[model samples]
Target: MTQPMVKKMSEEQQHLVMQSMDMMDRFYDEEFGLLRSSGEESSAHGTRGSAHYALGLLIRQKSGDVERAVRVLHKVLDYQYDAPEEIYHGTFATQSTDEHPPAGHYAWKSFAPGTAYFLERTFEKVSEAFIHKLQEENNLLKEEADVKQLRQLFYASVHGVLPPVWISYDPNWREFIACVCAIASAAFSELLPDALIQRMDEAMERAVQGSVDRRLSDAIPMNTNIELMHIFITHYYGHRLKRADWMQHADEQAEGLLHEFEQYGGTFAEFNTTTYYGVDLAVLGMFRRYAFTERMTEIAHRLEHGLWNNIALYYNAKLENLSGPFARAYDMEMREHSSIGVFLYLLLGKGYEHLTGMNCESGHDPMIALLGIDVPAEAVPYFQAHQGDRLVQKQFLELCERDDPKANRNLCTASAWIGENRMMGAMSGSRNTNGQMHPATIHWQTETGERYYLRLIRRETGGDWNSHLRGITFEAEVTPDSLNIDVQLDTAEEIEVYFEIKGPSIRHQDIQPERWELPGLTCTVKAEAPEPTMLMYTDYAEIIYRYVPGKSENRMRFELGISD
Candidate 1:
C-alpha cells in the first residue's frame, strides 16, 4: 500500500504555525530543553508540552531548530518512567517541579502519540541531517541507547503499561488505542524486532475484536473528539495492516457522524466546547491527509466545513468569544487561551485579539498545521463580517439506550441569541453531570470596556457548584433578552441556584431582592423564593437562592431578563 501524502502548507498557514511557535518559545527552558507550563506565572515544566513543542520545531524545517527539537525530545524521554515491573511503567508526568516528581500515569495518552508521530514522520520524510541530529542527541543523553534502542524502549513501555481491559470499557478508549496504533505503526515502519511486532499485532487484533464485539463504531452520542480519533486511526491502521473489518468500521462511523451532523443542523453532542473542538479539527485533518477511501476523505472535508460554520455561528464578534450554553467547556469565557483559540489565531492570523496566549491543551495545533487544515473559504466570511442580532437553534442527541435505538430519548436542544452588546444561550435536556455543562449563560460588554459573564447553575446546598445536582432535571427557554429556567429535583434534596457573574465589583445595594443593576447590564429576577445571599470575590460574585423541600416549593422557576 502507498503511504498517505502530507498536505503542503500555504504561506499564511506557515506564518501562523511560526507565530504560535514564537509564543511557545517564550516558555521554553533553553538549558533544560523543556517548555514551562501553560500560564505566564507557571514555573513548572510539562512533558507533553515539551514533546509537542518539538513537533512544532520540526515543522519549522531549520537545521538548528531540528537540533533543538532533538534535545527537547531527548529531555522528554528522560521523564518517562522505565521500570518494567511497575504499573505506571511508560507514563510521563503531566507537569513537574523541583519539589514534585513526575506522577501522572495518564500522561502517556497525551504525549505518546505525538512523540511517535514525530519519530515516524522524521524517519520516513525528514533529511539525513535530522536523523544525525537525533542520533547525536541520543548519544549525548545516553551512550548505550541509540535511536533504534530509544524506539524500542518507547514501544516496550507503552505496550507494557496499557491496561488489559477491553477497549470499550473506558469512555476514552479511542485515545488509548490510537496511541497504541501510533507507536506500533512507527515501530513497524522502522522494522523493529519481529517478536515485538508480533506482540503488537496481537494486541491490535484484540483491541479490534473488543471494539467489534461492543459495536463501538455504531455507538451514538460518543464524545465528539473520541469519535473522530477513532475514525481516523481505525482507517489508518486498517489500511496499514490490511484489515478490511477495521476499514469498514471506520467508513461506517465516519458516514454516521456526517449524517448526524447534517440531520441535526450541524451540532456536536459536545457542542461549542473550547477544548474538544480543536481535537475534533485535528482528527479531521488526519482524515483529510491519510484516509485511503475517497468517501472518507469527502466526509472529513464536509465535516470540517460544518464544524467551522457552527463555530462562526456561535462566535460573538463583539465579545471576542464564542457565546454559549456550552455542552461542555473548561472555561466560561474565551478571553483565556484555549485549544479552539489556537486554531482561530492560526486562521485569523496576528492581531486576532480574542486569544490571550497559547495554552498547554494546544498540542494538536502543530499536527493541524502540518496537515494543512484551515478554515474553509466559505466559513471565512462569517468570522470576518460583522455579526448582527440573530438566533441559532440546534438539536443534538444525548445518551442513547443501546438496546433500543428507537426510544426517542436522546433528543436535546440548544439555543443562542446574539445581539450587538450581549449574547445569551441555553440548553435543555443535557444530562451531563460533569461540571462542564453550562445550561444557561450570558456574556455582555460593559460600558467601561470590560466583558461580563453570567451563568446559572444548580447544585446541592453546599456541594461543589461545578458538578451537577444529582437526579435533577433542567430546562430553559431563551430569547434575545431573557431566559426562563425550570429546575426539578428528583429526591427533594435541598438545592441552591447560583447566579455566578464575573465583571467589575458589585455591592450589596447594587442587587435588590428581585432586581440588579450592574456595570454594563441590568437584570430583574422573577422567582417565588426569598432574597438571594451574596458571595463576593475579587473578580466575580455569586448570588445563591436556597430552596427547601416542603417548606417553600419543590419546583423552582427563574425568569431572568437583561435590560435594554
Candidate 2:
C-alpha cells in the first residue's frame, strides 16, 4: 500500500536516515571487504556485514571484477588471531580490540546464500582460481614420511582448520564452512599436490579420531565449521554432500536445533549474526536425506508464512508488520520487503514443490507458487471473508468524495468471492446514513452464503434505548437453517433477519466447537426480541461475543486451517 500522503522529511529526519544508511554502507564495506576468516572479530557487533561480502561478490561478478572477488574470498583463509583455538569472528566484542585477543567467530556460516550466490555467479573464474592455486604449489604434495612436509601441505591447502566447536560460531548451525573448504580444496586439487591430499587425508582421519562423543560434546563447532552452505548449494550445483556420511551427530544436533528454533518462533534469536542463515537452515531441512522430520517441514512452512498481520490492516488490506528479530535495527521502510523476499525464496524453493505433490485433507485445494513447489497454501480466505467491512467503508468513502449522495447514502454490503465450498469476502461495506436517517433497505447479491458481517454497537445505553435493529441480511444460493459468520460484539443486541433466497432459516451456531463463536448471554428489554444467548461457536466460522467497556480492541479472530 502506497502512502498517498508521504511525510516530507524534515532536515533532522533527512540527516537521521542518511546517517543510518551511511553507517550501514560503511560497516558492510569494511567487514565484508576482505575474505578473512569468521574468527576475525569486528569492533562493531550487529553492524558487521557478512551479507555485504556476498553482495560485493555479486557486484564483482556482474561488473566483470572476478579477480578481485576471488581475492577477497581468498582472504578469509588468512584470518589470524592470538589464539586459533577460539574461532570467534565478529567485528565487535565485549573486550577491547587492543591487547585483548580477537574472538574467532564464523561469520560465513550465516552468510551462505550471499556467498553461494556470488560463487555460483563467478564459478567460471572460480574454476580457474582453484586451478591456479592447485598448479602453483606443486612441490608440497609428494608423499614423504616427513612431518614437516605433511604439516606444511596441510597448512597450504587449508584456509584454517579450527576445532569442531567454534566458540564464536552458532552451536546448532550446519556446516557451511565445510562446503566452502571442500570446493576450494577440490578446485585447488593440483596444488593440493598428491602429498598434500595424502597428508590432509591423514589429517582428516586424525581429525575424526576424536570419537563421536568428543565431536558431539562440542559447541558452535567453530574449528571445523565452514562451507555447509556450499555443500547444500552443491545439491543444486550437481554435487550431493551426504549429511549422514559427513557427521551423523551433527545432523542429530540439527534436528534439536530446528525444534528449539521453532520454539523461538522461527527467529534465530540465540544465534546473533547479522546474516539470516536461518533461511538457509530452513531450506536445508527440506532436503530428501535429512527429511528433517515432519516437524521440520511444518517449521519451515510457518516460518515462511508467519508475519505480523494487523487485523485493522488485514480487514482493510492484508499488510504484514515486520517488527521481528531479523528486523535488526528495524528499518520499517524495507522490513516487510526483506522478510517477504526470504519467505518467497523458501516458498518457491521448497514450499511450492511440497504443496504441488500432496493432497490437502482440508477439502480445499492447495495453491502452488510460481515455481510450483507442492506446499499447502495458507488459508487466506478466512481474513478475506471478513474484509467486507473494510471494502464497504472504502466504497462509502469513495462515494462521499464523488458527491454521489444516492450511492453514498445507501448502505453498502460487504462482498465475497466464493469458490466451490469456501466463502471469502474480498471487500465489505455497510449502510451509509444520509441526513441522520440510516437507510433500512440493503441489497446483497450472492450466488451462495459466502460473505456476511453485521454488528450494532451500543453505547452502554441501558435496557430502555439499547434495543436497536442490527440484523445480518443474507442471500444464499442454497439456504439452510442458518449460515455461520465470525462475529464478536462488546454489548448485547438483537438481530432481525431478512433472507432473500429460499427459506429464512440460518442456523448461525452449529459449527466447529474448537473455534468457540458464542460470546456471552444477556436478555434485554428490546421491542422485537427473542431471548438469544451470545453464541461462541468455535468450530464454525463465526462468533457473537459481548464486549467489555473501555476494552474495545479485542477482535474476533478468523483463522485459516488447511489440512493435508
Candidate 3:
C-alpha cells in the first residue's frame, strides 16, 4: 500500500501551479534594486526608484514573502513617478528624462488609486499576519492633510466625484481613486475603521443603482469596467448587500445582468465609437462576467485565453513599448514604466505590440494625428494573432447574429453602447477610389481635411430628427479640389432632407445638395467653417438632435485641424 498511498500530485495540478508561479515572476525586476515592470520608462514620465501599488499586489499574492513585499511596496508608495497624478507604479518604465520631473509631492489619485489599493491591501494582509497593525490614523493619513481630505479622496474613488466631459478631464485622479476603492473593499477590509467600512459599503451600493446619481455620472472614475465590476460584485455578494443571505442576492444580480445581456446585444456596434473610451470598459465588463451565455461563450473563452495565457508567452516587451501613456514595468534593463502595462502583463502577456501604431500613408496618418499616441512598429501576436478576428466573426454570426438559426434571444444589455446611446447610423471606415466605400462597417473620409468628425444622420419627416437628436455620423462627398456638404433631414417617415443656416455666421441659408432619401442626411455641403482650426478629435459617429429653427441643435457639425 506504499505508506497508505499518499500519492503525489497530478501533472495537471502541478502544471497549474507552475503556470501561476510563472505569472507571479513575470513582472519582477531584480536589477535597479526594484520590482518595476517594462514601459514605465518608455517615456520620461515617472520618478527615480519610485515604487507603485502594483508591486504590493504581487507581494501579497506570494504566500511566504508578505513582509518583504510589504517593505518594497511601502518604499514605492512613498516614491513619486511624476505622472499628472498618482497611480500604481508597476509596468511602464520611468526614464531619466528632464521632461516630466516629479511633482515634489507624493499623491494617490494620479495613477488612479492603483498603488493606494496596494497599500490598502497590504494593511489588511499585515493585520492577518498577526503582525502588529499600523493604526489607521498613523498610516492612512500618514502624509495626508486632514482626515476630511483623506476620506473625500477615498469617496471620490467610489462616487466618481469629479467633473463631466473632457475639457477638464484628468485621467490620473480618476484611475488612482477608483483603484483605491477596489483595494479597500476587496483586500483591505482590516485597514479601515468599522465606521469607514460601513460608509464604503453604502457608496458601493449606490454605484450599481445610481444611474441618475449625478455624482457617479458627472465625473469619470478610474478603473476598467471589468475591474470596477469585479469589486462591485464582490462587495454585493461577499458582504451580502442586497439580501440577508449575500451570496443569494449576488447570484440573483449576476443572473439578471446576464439576462440583460441576452435582451439587448446587437446595439453595441450601433452606438460604439473610437473617440469615447467608455464603451470599452462596459464591454469588457459584459464579456468577462457573462461571456459564455448562450450568445458568445466560446468567443469569450478565446478572448480571455488570448489576453492572459497567450500574450505573456511572447517576446521581451517594454512598458514604453505599449501605446498607452502610463508605463508600470520596472526592469533591470529599464527604470519607471507603465503601471497598467505590468498589471495587464500578468493577464494579457508582454506583447504590447498592439497599443500603438497604424497602417496608413505617412502624410495622411489621420489616426496617429488624431489619437496623439505613438505609432509603434507593426508587430504580430506572440501566439496566434490571426486566429482572433475570424474566429470572433464566426462566433458573432453563430451566437450573436440576429438571423441565426437559434432565432432571437434578446442578447442585449442596458450597458451595451448601442442601447444606451440610441443615436443615428453614421457612416464609418475609410474610402476607396471610385468614391465607393469598401463595405466597411462604418467609415468616413474628409477630402478637404477640414471637418472635425464625419457624421451620418437620418430623419423620418421634414422636421428635427427628434427632441435631442441621437449621435454623430460620417458622410461627406469630397473631391480633389472641392468638398460638398449635404444633409437631408427627413422627419416625414418617408425620409426627408432639409438645409438650415443658423449660428452667428454659420450659414447664409440652408444648403441641401442633391438629396433623395432621408437615410442619407449628410454630404459635403462645404462652407469651410472657420478653416477647421478648432480640433479636439474627429471620428465616425451617428446621432440625432432637435432643431429649434435658429439653433441647429442636432445640426451636422464638422471641423478640421493640422495633424502631427
Candidate 4:
C-alpha cells in the first residue's frame, strides 16, 4: 500500500497545531507518561488523551517529539486490561491515576483502531533506524529485535486482544466492529495468526450482514457519524481484502445516504450538531482517503464540502461560536471548545484565538490530522466575513414511515437570524430530547464586549429536568429580533419553562409579574402561571416559570435586542 499524499499545513494551521501541542504539554505527566484529563482538577491520566497527544506530537514532527510520542504510546498500551476472562478485556481505561487500571467498556472502539492507525502511519513515515533508536532509548525492545518485531509487538498489544473480546462481547455497534476488522486487514493482516484472521473475517461478515439486514427492513437514516463509519470501513476493507460482496454493500449504503442527504435539503438527521458534526467530517475524510470507487470518493468530497458550508452559515464571528437551535450539542458555547471548535480553529487560524479551549478533550484533531482533511476553501469566507442582518432557514426530513417514504414525519424546521453583534436561532418539530436538543437559543455581545447565551427549555416538573418536555408538541416562530413559541402538551402535568442564561455581570428585572428583562433580552410568559422566578448561581442564571396541571397549551415570547 502506498502512503496517501497530504497537503502541507498553512502557516496559520501550523500555529493552531503548535497551540494544541503546548496545551498537551502542560497537561502531560512526565512520570506517568500520559496526559491529564482536561477540565478536571485531578492528576488522573486519560488514555484517549495520551493517544491523541502522541498523534499530535507525531504530526508536529519536531526534534525529540517522536521519542516522546513513542513513550506515551507505550504507557497507554500498559493501561489496557489484558485479562481474557474480564468483561472489560481488550479495552483501555478512560482515565486513571492507578498504574494498572481497569478497562472502560467503549474505550477500545476509538483508541484501539486509532492507535493502530498511528502505528501504521508511523511505519510508513519514519525510518527503521530512527525507530530502532527510539526503541533503544525507551528500552521498548531487545537489542536484536528488528523493526518487524517491534511493529508486531505494538499491533498485537492493541489488535491481538480484540477478536476474543469482540466475539464474546458482541457489541451492537457494527460500525466499530467493522472498523477493527478494516484496520486489521489494512495494516496487520500478515502479522496476525491464521486463527485470528479467520475470527476477524467472520466478524466483518457478520457486521456486513447485519447492516444489509437493517437496510432491507428499515429506510430511515442511521446515525450520521456511525453510518459514515460503516460506509468507510466496508469500502476500505472490501478493497483491501478483495471482497466484492462488501464493496457492493458499501456502494449501496453510500448511495442511499446520498439520496437522503439530497432529499432532506443537504442536512443530516443529526443536523448542525457541535459534537457529532466533527465525527461526521472525520469519517467523510476517511472516505475521501480510502473509498475504493471514484463515485464513492466524489460523494465523500461533496458531503464534506456541504457540511463545512453549513458550519460557515451557523458560525457567529462575534461570539466565536456556532449559533443554535443545535439538533445536538454538548456545550451551548463553542468558546468552551466543543468538538466543532477544533475544526473552526483549524480553519479560521490566527483570528480564532478566542476558541482557547483546544485542550478541552482529545477531540477528532488526531483523526483529522491523520486523514489530512481541510475545510473547503469556498466556505472559509463566511466563517470570518463581516456579519450582516440575515435570515437562514432550513428544513430537514428526520424520518419516514417504513411503508411510504412520502409519509414523512419529524420534519426539523430551523431558522437563524444572524445579526451584526448577536445571533438567535430556533427549531421546532424535533422529537429529540434528553438535553441534546436546544430548540431555541440566543447569543449576544454585550456593550462591554462580553458574550452571553440564553436558551429555552420545556420540562415536566418531576421528570428528567435535562430533557425537553415530553408528550408535548411545540413550534417556534423566529424573526430577526424575537421568538414566539407555542407548546401543546398531551397530559395535564406540572410544567416548567426554563430560560437558562450564562455570562458575566448578568442582572435581571421584572417588568411585570410575567415579563422579565435581562442583559440583552426580554421574556414574556402568557400561561396560567405564577410570577417567574430568577435563580442565580456563580456563573449562570435560570429564569423558571412554573405552571400547575390543567393547562395543556402555553405560549411564550422572547424579545432580543435590548442593550446592556
Candidate 5:
C-alpha cells in the first residue's frame, strides 16, 4: 500500500484538475492577503485556514506552482506560534477575535484539534513539496524558521496544559484528532527534540487513557470508525504505553461495526446521504490502507462493501438524489449523487462515469492521491446496476435502527425516486425534529420545470408529556408517484397535520381538507381520516386530523403526477 504511484493523469483529468484550480481561486482572498473567511476576529477562522491549506496543496500538486502554494501555506504558519512562557495562550487564537477577550477573561482558547490536524498534515505535504525550493532561492515568502515554528507549535498545542479541548461531541472529530495525533507524532518523532518527544508521548497517553477511562466512567456509545482508529493507534503504540485495557473500547466498536455491516450491509450513522457516506467510506478506506493488519483488513473490506451496497441500492442517477426517507438527515437537499459518487468512482475505478458532469468541489479527501488506493473490481457491478436507464429507484426497510445519541429510535421508511424528484416517508419511530425528519418528504420537479421540496408533518397534541409527539407503530405504503403513511399515536388525542412546501415554482390555492391544489403542476393533496378535520393555510397549509385512541390509524396520502 505504501508503494509509489505510477499512474499518470489523463488529458481529461488534466482539464478537470485545471477547472478545480479555477473553482478554488475564489476561496483565496487576494485583497486581504489571506484565505476567504480567514477573519481572525470572526468566527470559523480555523476552518477557513484549513480549507485554504488543503485546497492550496491540491492546486500546488496539480499546477506545480510553488509561489502560489507558498502564499496559502504561510497563512497557516503565520496563524500558529510558539511562546516560551505561556504555551497554550500564545498558540493559535482560540476561535476568533471576539473570542480573544480582555486579559483575564477565561475564554479557553481551545484550538480545534481536528482543524489543526488537517492544516498540519497539509503543511507536511507542502513542506516536502516546496520547502527545499523556497530555502534554496530564499523566496522570502516562507523559510525553514517558519517550518521550525510550526513544529514547535504542534508540540505545544498537542502537549499543552488543558489537553486540546477535543472540541465537539462528535466522535468523527475525536477520531480524526486521535488518528492525526498518532500520525503526526510518528512523522515528527525523530525530528522533534527529546523533550518534545516525551511530551507528545504523554499527550497521546492521556488521550488513550482518557478514552478508556471514559468508557469505564460513562456508558460509552460506539462510533465504528472512531473506535477502529483508536484501536489502531493504541495497538500501534501499546508497547510503549502500559495500558492493558487500551484496545477493549476499540474492539467493542469494531465488533459493533461488523455486526451492523453483516446485518444491514452498511450503516449510515449520520442522516446526510451525501456527505457522511463519503466521509465514512474515506475513513474506512484509510483504516484499510494505513492500519493494514490481517484482521483489520478483513473488517475494513467488509465495511467498505457494505457501504457500497447501500450507495448502489439508493442511488438515483437521473435525479442526483439518494432517494431517502433518511433515518437522520441534515437537510432535504442531498448532493449524494455528485460528491459520494465521485469518491466511490475513485475507490472503484468504474464508477467515474457517474461523476461525468457532477460538481467536484475543493477540500475533498486528499488521500485519493496520498494513499494511492484503487477501487476493487467487486464494486464495479454494484455501480453499473444503479447507474442505468432507470427512472425510479424504490426501496423499503421494515425496521431500520440508528445508533444516534439524540435519536435511539427505529422506523419504517421507504424511498420513491421518480426522475430528479424523491418522495420519501417514515411512519413510526421518534424523530429528532431538529433533523427535519417529517413523516413525508416529497422532493420533486414540478410540471413548470422547477425543483420543489415539501414537508408533510402530522403534528399531534394530547399525546405524551413531551413537546415532540413520537409516532408509534408506523405503516408506509410506497407507490410510483405517492406514499401513504399510516401512523399510530400514543394517545387518541386530536392532532393537526400540515404541509409546508418550499420550492421555486410552487403556489398554494383552493386549500381545503379534502382537496388542495398547486397550480401548474399535476400535484394534488388530500387528507381523509376516520373523522372530519379542520383545514387552513398558515405559512403553507394545515390539516387538523383527529385520531381516536384504540380506534384506527391516521392515514395521509400524498400523490405527484410527475413520474413516468
Candidate 6:
C-alpha cells in the first residue's frame, strides 16, 4: 500500500496566493470608503461609483465570497435611474463644469452599461450551481428580479438610436459596449425572453455595422482592444448578426494600421510609450487567448510583436525607464521611468526579465486573471533585442517628418542631448497650454536648467500681445546648445516672440547689444520686427523680439551656449 504520495502546494505558492487575496480585500475596503464618504448613494449608477461597485463585486467573486457577491448583484439589479435621451441618439456632451453634468451620468448610451453587462456574465459563470440556492435563501428570483432594466438599455441600442449629428468618434466605447451586448445575447439565451434576446442580437449588429467619420482620421488605427472585440463578436455572434461588408472594412482597416510599422521601420509614427501603448499591450494579450480565425489570430500576433519591438526600442533596463519624445503627454513634467512592461509578464507569460519596476503583488484586477494569455515563442525576438539606448535619434527623426504644423498639441523632436551633464530636446505648440497665449516653441532643459520657454504672440492695437494665428509652420534645426527656428504663417499679421531663461538664482548681465550673459549660459536674440525689449530678473531673463512678416517667410534664431 506504498502507493503514490499526494501532491501539495509549495510554501512559496501558498504565500503568494494568500498575499494576493489580502490585497484584493484591502482594495475593496478602500473603494467602499470612497463610495460612502463621497455622497454617492447607489452602486449601479454614475461613472466612477458604478465602476468601484462592479470592481468590488468582482473582487468578492475572486475571494470566494459568493454570497456577498450575489447581494451586490441584486443591488445592481434593483437600482433604478433615468436614462438620458442623448444616449439613445448616440451623442454625448463632452464638457463637465458647475452647470453641466457629464454625459457618463446617463449609463445606457455612454458605454457605462458595458460594465454591468460584463458583471452579469461573470455572475453567471461563478454562480452556476448556487443560482437556485441563492433564490431559495433570499427569494432573489421574483418576477421583478428579471433583467428588465438591461433589456431596456438593449432595446434603445437595437432600433438605431441616432443623434442630430452622429459621428464615428470614440470607437473604443462603441465597440466595447457592442461586444458586451453580443456576449450577453449568446450567454443569456435561456434566461432572457426571446423578444429581448432578438433585440440584443440586433443591437450587436447595429454596433459593429456603424460607420466611422471619414473626415477626421486617427493617427493610429482603432486600438487592439477594439480589434479584439471585433474578432470576438465575429467569432461567437456572427451567425446571429448580418454584417459581411463591415467585417471586410475591418480587415482593410487592420491592414492599413499594421502597414504603419512596416513603412516606418518597426515603429508607430507617434511613439507614446506611457499610458496608451501599455494599456494596448495588456488588452491585446487578453484577447489573444480567445479562439479566432487564422488570419485574425496572425494579425493579433503581429500586433503584439510590433508593440513589443517599439517598447523595447525605448526601454532603459538600468534605470527601468521608457524614454520618450511624446507628441501628447499628461503635462510638462516628463516621465523618467515606467514599469508597465511587468504587466506583460503578469498577463502574458512572457517578457519577464526584459522589464522591471512594477510590483506584481499589488495586481488584483479580475480581468487579468479571467483573460490570462500565453505568449507565443515567435515573440521572443522582441524580448531578446537590446533594451537600453541613450538616444533614439533615428526613430524621432522619422516622427519629425510627420509633424503637423497646425496641431494645437506640442510636436516634440528626439533628444538632442542625452549625456551625463544634461538631457534636452525641442518642441512647438500652436494654442496648447504649453503654448502660453501664443504659438510657442520650447527647448526642453530638464537636467540642465529650469526650462527655456518661448511663445510667439500677436502685437496689435490697445497694446494687446495675446492672440496667435493657427495656420503657421514652425521648422527647427536643433543643436546641443542652440535652436535655429524658421516660422512661416499664412497670415500677414505682425507677431512678437517672447523668450525666457529660467533656473536657480540665475542672474544675467549684458555682454553685447542683444547678447545676455549668465552663469553657464549665454543668449543672443535675433529679431525680424523691431528693437528688442529685454527684462532681467533674479532667477531669469525675459526677451521680447517683434516679427514683421515679409512676403515669403520670417526667420528668428535663438543661439544659446550651455555650460554646466
Best by TM-score: 1
| Candidate 4 residue pairs that clash | none
Between candidates 1 and 6, the lDDT winner: 1
TM-score of predicted structure 3: 0.30
Clashing pairs in 5: 41-97, 271-328, 319-420, 347-375, 348-375, 492-549
Candidate 1 lDDT tens digits, 1-564? 222111246554565566667788888988667888866557788766676676677666554765686567556555543433322333444565622222334333233323322433343344335446666775443453354465555544543444311211232443443443443345223333454445445444544444443344233234677668767767777877898988888888888889888888887667887777877887777777667789888899888888998888888766777888887776776745366666776677667634635565555455566665557786776666546789988788764212223342356788999887888988887765556778889889876678889898777775676653445666887997898888766645577777888887767678876888888889898975656788888878888888777765666778997885
- Give me the runs in candidate 1 sitting further than 4 Å from their true place: 1-50, 61-221, 353-356, 400-409, 491-494, 548-552
Candidate 6: list runs displaced more than 4 Å.
1-172, 176-203, 211-242, 317-321, 332-389, 394-422, 426-469, 477-555, 559-564
Q: What tens digits encode model 4's per-residue C-alpha lDDT throughout 1-564?
A: 322112256654555566677777888887778887754355777766666676667566666765786677566655544444333333455567533322333233233323322443454345455566778797665554465576556555544443322223322245543553454345334434565566556545555555544444332224577678778877886776688887888888889888878786688877877777877876786777667779999999888888888888887766767888887776787655355666666666676655545636434354465555567887787777745678998887654211123333477888888886788888888755345677788888866787788887767775555553345555676787577665555544578777788887765543345555656656554544346777788868887777665543354444433332
**Per-residue alpha-carbon lDDT of model 2 for 1-564, expressed as tens digits?**
221111232332222223332333343335444422223445422211232232233221323333433443343332312232333321112212222332354343444223322332244345445544554666432442343354445433332333222222332222232222333334333323364445333322322222221233222121111222322332322222343444444445455445544553433321211123222333333332233345434433443343212112222112221111111111221122122222222333432222122111100010001011222344244333333332211111112211222232222332322222222232123321111111111112234433222222222222221222222222211111112223233322232221111112224543232332222211111111222244323322222233343443323322222111
Error of 2 at 396 (Å): 42
Write down the lDDT of every candidate, Cα atoms only.
0.65, 0.27, 0.27, 0.63, 0.45, 0.40
lDDT comparing candidate 6 with the true structure: 0.40
- Candidate 2 is scored at a TM of 0.30
Best to worst by TM-score, what's the order? Answer: 1, 4, 5, 6, 3, 2
TM-score list, all predictions: 0.71, 0.30, 0.30, 0.69, 0.58, 0.50
Q: What is the C-alpha RMSD of each candidate to the true structure, in Å?
A: 15.0, 26.4, 20.0, 16.0, 16.1, 17.0
The list of candidate 5 runs beyond 4 A from truth reads: 1-44, 47-172, 180-244, 265-272, 336-338, 344-362, 368-439, 445-452, 457-475, 486-503, 510-521, 528-564
What lDDT is reached at residue 323 by model 6? Answer: 41
N/CA/C clash count, model 4: 0
Q: Scored by Cα lDDT, where does model 2 land?
A: 0.27
Cα-based RMSD of candidate 6: 17.0
Q: Point out where model 2 deviates above 4 Å.
A: 1-52, 55-60, 80-215, 218-245, 254-317, 322-338, 341-376, 379-564
